[model samples]
Target: MHDFDFVRPQTVSDAVRALATPDAQALSGGQTLLPAMKVRLAAPAVLVSLMHIPDMVFVRADGDVLRVGGATTHAQVAREAAGAYPALASLAARIGDPAVRSRGTIGGSLANNDPSACYPAGVLASNATIVTDRREIGADDFFQGMFTTALEEGEIVVEVRFPIPDAARYEKFIQPASRFPLTAAFVARHSGGARVAITGASESGVFRWHEAEVALTSDFAVQALDGLAVDADGMIADLHGSSAYRAHLAGVMTRRAVAAIV
Candidate 1:
């Protein structure tokens, strides 16, 4: 790993200032960043730690939304959000192993925006808001592509606000080695409508399966998806599975998620 200056900031403003240093990068959990650094995939001049910022670590329900601080760990979400949003909690619980769960933060996950990561599906399906130090970005606009997001330099994610759905569930077909989803689906039904988000299968990144959403919105049942199918053209094809295979799993996982909620 390259030598880098490390700064632990106690406040969001301090962290932002620290990030202004040349080639500086924000550090939260260090689950993905650290690994990249070791392989020389990333070489930042400085590391601005957000873990020390108090306001970046919290979980609470504000009226209709479940507000989760950006620095809050996956384990924290698993424990704190279960009562208010069980589907989110369940997704958090299943991310990586206990060690990763304890260290990985929701903000880090979203900011990193790994195509196979679990949180994006939940955020997109729930139509959550990604609150940054500068402004609030809807999940639809936040994710750009694999390992990409709308976050700008020196910006920091403060928290995420998820609208509580009447019923929601996430289902994933895991790749045994990394525990990342090979194909995953998150289905959320609200008073307004039903939304379906799929991850792990798309080459472009996590995306909504609109046809299934429309079908399920009209009839909230697993059988409603019986005739529906996900197109293979946009799916990621690798050693674990072919594009068609992952596309099939997307439908299967979506069906399972709907079944769980129904």
Candidate 2:
């Protein structure tokens, strides 16, 4: 990483002001940022660390929302919400083992918006609210594309808010090397409906599967989605697997997630 001005602001307002410049970047868990920086892909002139902010590393239920702060690590999520949000907690626990989970934050995962990451699918399926310093975003609007999101420059994600669902489960096919999901599925069934979201398949990034959703929505049974096929047009091709293989895994994981939820 190149030499940069490091600002450890204690307040959200200060962090916002500090990141007002175009070259400034927010540093959360540094799980992705540090690696990207090492590869010389990220060379921010100023790095604003969100760790010092009070309440930015917490997880609790407020009103009807399960709030998880941006700086809150995956280990924290796994510990705090493990029983409450089983699927989300399971996903957090499976995030790069004990060491990475200890360092990787929920906010960091959301901020990086990696196409292959677990949280996006979990958030979307759980109908979570992505609360930023500026505003709140619906899960659908939060994720945009590969390494991209709805986050504006200088606008940082402060926390994530998820509504309690009736039941939820996550199933993933992880790549042996990086451990990122080759294809991951998050399924949540509430009084309203059942949502199914897939990660690590699409080129444009995380997306909800409407087909499997239809089956789960109609009948929450695993066998209900027997022949449902995931559309592969939007999926990405990679060395880990072909587009066809990933699309197949998307359906396989979708069924498995539905099974796990029930």
Candidate 3:
């Protein structure tokens, strides 16, 4: 890794202050950032670690929402959020192997906004609120596209508030080697309606399968999705899977998620 100064801040405000400096980047978990640094894909002059910030690591359940601090580790979410939000917890449990899970933070995941990452699907499906140091951004507005978000420079994700769904499930078709999804679906049924979010398949990044959501909202069952199809026009196509294959998987996974929840 290139030479850089590292600072661990004890509070969100402090971390924000540190990140305000030119060429300084916020560090959380280091799962994505450190690897990039080592490969010289990213080279920030200063690494401002958010892990030590007290307000950025915890899990709590409010009336109908599960609140997770940004710096909270996947393992922590897996254990702490199980009772309050089992489906989301399950998603966290399946993110990566033990080592990656232990180190990766939800904030980092969402901030990086990798198209294949799992949290975007869950957060979007749940219509969660992303609380940043600057303001609260709705999940719908938070994720702009692949590896992109609404966060401005130096803004820190303080917390994420996920509304506890009546029933929800995340189904992933893993690539096995990387453990990232070849295609995945997160289905959440609320009192008002249902939401279906697809990840790991779209070229534009994670997106809602609105047709499936409409059908599922009308009838929350596997049979509700009988004729629904995921369009392949904008799906990711590569060696692992074709756009058509991933599109097909998106439908299958969404059906599986509905089946589990129903």
Looking at candidate 2, the ten consecutive residues that score lowest on lDDT are 81-90
lDDT of each: 0.95, 0.88, 0.94
Query: For model 2, how does the per-residue alpha-carbon lDDT over 1-262 read when each residue is reduced to its tens digit?
Result: 7989999999889999999976999998788899989989999999999888986888887775688888899998999987677778889988877888888888889988899999999999988989999899999898988889899888888999999788888998988688889999988897888998999999989998988888888889988898889877878897788889899999899888777767
Arranged by lDDT with the best first, the candidates are 1, 3, 2
After superposition, the stretches of candidate 1 with alpha carbons farther than 4 Å from their true spots are: none
Error of 2 at 187 (Å): 0.4
Per-residue CA lDDT of candidate 1, range 103-201, in tens?
999999999999999999999999999999989999999989988899999889999999999999999899989999999999999898899999999
What are the RMSDs of all candidates, in order? 0.7, 1.2, 0.6
The better candidate by TM-score, 2 or 3, is 3
lDDT of 3 by residue, 129-173 (tens): 999998999999988988999999999999999999999999999
TM-score of predicted structure 1? 0.99
**Model 2, residue 247: displacement in angstroms?**
0.5
Q: So what's the TM-score on candidate 2?
A: 0.97
Candidate 3, which segments miss by more than 4 Å at Cα? none
Looking at model 3, which ten-residue stretch has the lowest summed lDDT? 219-228
